[model samples]
Target: MTLRILILLGALSAFGPLAIDLYLPAFPALAQAFGTDIEHVQLTLAAYFVGLAIGQLIYGPLIDRFGRRGPLLIGVVLFSLSSLACALVPDLDWMVAARFIQALGGCVGMVAARTVVRDLCDPTTTAKVFSQLVLVMGVAPILAPVLGGVLLAAFGWPSMFIVLALFGSVCGLAVWRWLPETYPADMPRRPLGGALANYGRLLRDSSFVGNALAGGFAMGGMFAYIAGSPFVYIELYEVSTQHYAWLFGLNAAGFILLAQVNAALMRLRGPQFWLMRWVWVHFASGMALLAVALAQPAALWPLLLPLFCSIASLGCIMPNATACALARHGANAGSASALLGSLQFSIAAVTSAMVGALHDGSSVPLAGVIAVCALLALALTVWTASRD
Candidate 1:
């Protein structure tokens, strides 16, 4: 892929992360403003994940039928409008609703970006391309929370939504002006019924299913971190909001850096080779995290270290596993990408909700859930490795 194309695709894929991470520092403020608890505000994040999970399924077939650009344009427009709605919401309920709508719009970019990669690149190159895209995508998480902290301290939480709206608008214009429709209109389009069948076929494919599950469970661990970190760092550790933002950014930086390392290692190793190694790393780090949390350590650094290591492992797993899954389905790249994304986000939504539901003023719930996700991912990896 050209640098220009990589940048554009990366930006498109980064929308979801930007939306999630940029407002994280404002969670306490949002709860206070709405006269609700932090957990209620957390439902907005869960709602966004739910929207992403379902919206991709809808867009997958539409993109295949209509081609990529049209659905992408519409999704960005919807995302922009919903972001505005979020900024203007009258209450927490409206905020949650608006976030769901925002996710519906934002997810089109994700599905379309992956489909376009499949359309343009061969399988070997796809893994490299995805790693490069992850590098580009990594910028949002690295900067978002810090920017959010500054904005939250100076302007307030609603300003974050305004920034998100502006981001969507800019990305929409970029897609319109630059992103070519990779899916040709003349391509054979699956009928709606056939599309559902396509999903069934994918599910039954042991390789695809295993890779998807492995990636999904790893992503679930990340979502658990996202959902529970604010409480763990700020409420439990008694960190300031500014410090919390930096801490969040620190973990994101580790993730980005390791992704670059994965890209480098991919030159010498197969994607699956690296994926297996990282899955083990993730499992080990997660176990260590659980050990620390269970012991009730007096200092926060013990927990933070393993937590950072676990999240960083995702930098290796996500791009490689996604490339592996999509590599198996060239003829139906859109559907394949959709199923992969939907499964990943669906897992994320469940993990996030579980974290919230299991919140008990302790770090054990988050650590326990993260450990389980990592273990499940490792099992999936081992099961699939033999097949490969």
Candidate 2:
């Protein structure tokens, strides 16, 4: 791949994580800014997941019709504008609303970028490429929060949104200037009914649904950690918000480095082997976490260590699961990619919300949710493998 193309795809992947994570240090501040509770501020994060889920489904068909350029350009522009709106909002409600809009604007890039990768390579290669893709994707989550912490200390929550706005704008311009349109002229623009019908069919396909759920549940478990960790780390463990940023960034660094390892392993084992092995490891992680949660630590450090291991394993899960699901159906890749993304985000929102709702200012709640999700994903993966 051209360095330029890789960068463009990587940036496109980065926008979602950057949009969500960059504002994390601002979470507590936003609660204070609007005279709201921390739980209310958290709902804003959940709202973004809802928007991302809904937007992914819409953009899937739209990209198939319009090709990747127009929809992607539009999404990035809107994402930038929404970031500014979020920065300027006077109340919690307004911030929540703006975040939803920002998520909508950011959704197209993810779907299109994955579709574009699949277009350029076949399923197995798609898996290999995504190992690299995710390392690029990992940069945002790894840095955004640390950057958010710095921005928060220097400029406050409002300024964080401004940084987000600036980030979005820079990405938008880079996309417009540097990225080539990959969808071919010969690609058919399906009618709305045809697109819907295609989605309906894929949803019914047991194998597709199986892989999709295997991936979605795997991500939902991670998203549960994402949604609940700020509370658990900062509130329960009583870590400083800035320190939490550093800690969050550290785990992402683990993910980034491990993704590089997964990429290298793909050369030897292939996507299928690596993914199967990863799922088994995750299943074991779930059991380990369950045991840890039951043990109930007085200090957070021990639990935190293994938790990082599980989260890091997603380095193996996300990219491989995605590439496997997008393997066939090149004719309807946009819709397939879209639905896969939508289900992942949608499942994540629901799972995260459950964790948020159940938050008890203790590690048990977070650990319980994570373990359950991991267990379910493990069951599904095993079932899928046995069927074949």
Q: What is the lDDT of residue 164 in candidate 1?
A: 93
**Best-fitting candidate, scored by lDDT:** 1
lDDT of 1 at 95: 92
User: How much is the lDDT of residue 193 in candidate 1?
Assistant: 71
**Per-residue lDDT for 1-388 in model 2, tens only?**
6877887888888877888888887777887878986777888888888999999999998888888888899999999899899988888888889989999998888898898997788877787788788787888898889888888888887888788788778888888898877886677786666778889988887667777888899888888888888877888788897789888988888777777788788778766567788887887886787688778777778777777887888888877778777776788888898999899999888887888788766777778888888888788777766775
The clash number for model 2 is 0
Candidate 1 C-alpha lDDT tens digits along 1-388: 6788899999999989999999998999999999998888899999999999999999988888888899999999999999989999999999999999999999998999999999998876788788888889988988999999999999999999999999999999999998887875556877777888999999999889999999999999998999999899888899888888888888888888888888888789788898999999999999999999999887799998999999998988988898888887987888899989999999999999999999898899899999999999999999998998
lDDT of each: 0.91, 0.83
TM-score of each: 0.98, 0.97
Residue 382 deviation, candidate 2, in Å? 1.5
Off by over 4 Å in 2: none
